[model samples]
Target: MNFEAAKTLCRSFPGVTEDTKWGNDIVFSVGDKMFAVTNLGEATGMSFKVEDERFLELTDRPGIIPAPYLARAKWVYVEDAKALGDAEAAELLRRSYELVFGKLTKKLQREIGGA
Candidate 1:
C-alpha cells in the first residue's frame, strides 16, 4: 500500500498513536510499546510484531521477510504490499496491535480507558 494508506491502517487500531521515533521512521504504539513502524520517506517495507510461531510461518512465505534488526523479536516485513491484499494487511496490523495491547498491565489498560 501507499504511505498514507499504511499510516491510516496503523492509526485505525484502538489506543494506537503515531510518532517519529527513529530519524525517518514512523512508529505506531499502544501506550509506549510499538506494534508497527515504517520509513517515512520510502514505503519500501513495513514492520509489525507477530507471535513466534506465526512470525516463522509468515517469513517462510515467498514475499515476506524478517525485519532487519528486530527479526529476533518476532517482527516480520512485508516486502511487497501486493503479496497480501489490503484486507489481509489490515488483519495482520490488527493482530499486531492486539498482541501489544494485550500485554499492557491491567492498571495501564484502565488508565488508558480513562478509568
Candidate 2:
C-alpha cells in the first residue's frame, strides 16, 4: 500500500488522527499514543506496533524488520508495503490501533466513542 492508502485505512478507525513529524514521517495516533508511522522515505514503508510473537514471525519474512529505535517496544517495519498485502496490512493497523487505544483511560475511551 501507499501513503494515501495507509492514511485512509488508518483513519477509518475510531479516534485516529494523522500528522507529519520527525521531518518526513506521518504518524497515526489514538489518544496521544502512536500506533504507526511512515518510514523508508515517504510512504514506501511503514512501522507499527504488533504482538511480540507476530513481530518475530513477521520480521522473518522478506521486506519486514524490527523498527529502528522502537524495536524493543515491539514495533515492526514493513520495508515494502506491497509485501504485506492490503487486507493483512489493514488488519495489522487495526490491531495496532486497538492495542494503543485499549491503554487509554476509561474517560478517554468514552471520548473516542463520542468522537
Candidate 3:
C-alpha cells in the first residue's frame, strides 16, 4: 500500500497514534509501542511486524526484506509500496497492529478499549 493508504488503515485501528520519528519516518503505535513505520523522504517503503514463522518466507519474496534493526523481532520492510496487493497489505498491517496490541499490559489494553 502507498503511504496515504497505509496511514489511513493504521489510524482506523483502536487507540492508534501517529507520529513523525527520526525526521523522515512516520510511525504508527498502539499503547506507545510502534507497530508500523513508513518513510517520509524519497524512498517508498513501509515496515511492520510479522509473525515469527512468516519472517523468512516474507523476506524471501521480491520487494520485501527483513526490516533493518528490527529483523530480530520479525518485522519486514516492503521496499516497494505496491509490492503486495491492497488486500494483502491491509491484512499484514492489521496483523501487525494486533501483534503489538497483544503485547500491551491488560490494563493498558482495557484503557485503550482494544481488549
Q: Give per-residue CA lDDT, model 2, range 15-36, as digits (tens).
A: 8888878778888899989999
Show model 1 residue runs off by greater than 4 Å: 1-3
Error of 3 at 31 (Å): 0.3
TM-score of 1: 0.87
Looking at candidate 2, the ten consecutive residues that score lowest on lDDT are 37-46
- Residue 110 lDDT in model 3? 95
Tell me the deviation in Å of residue 40 in model 2: 10
Q: In model 3, what is the error at residue 30, expressed in angstroms?
A: 0.2
Candidate 2 colliding pairs, count: 0
List TM-score per model, in order. 0.87, 0.91, 0.92
Residue pairs in clash, model 2: none
Best by lDDT, which number? 3
> Where is the poorest 10-residue window by lDDT in model 1?
1-10
Q: Superposing all C-alpha atoms, what RMSD in Å does each candidate have to the true structure?
A: 1.9, 1.8, 1.8
Rank candidates, TM-score, best first. Answer: 3, 2, 1
In model 3, how large is the Cα lDDT of residue 80? 74
Q: State the RMSD for candidate 2.
A: 1.8
Q: Compute the lDDT for candidate 2.
A: 0.86
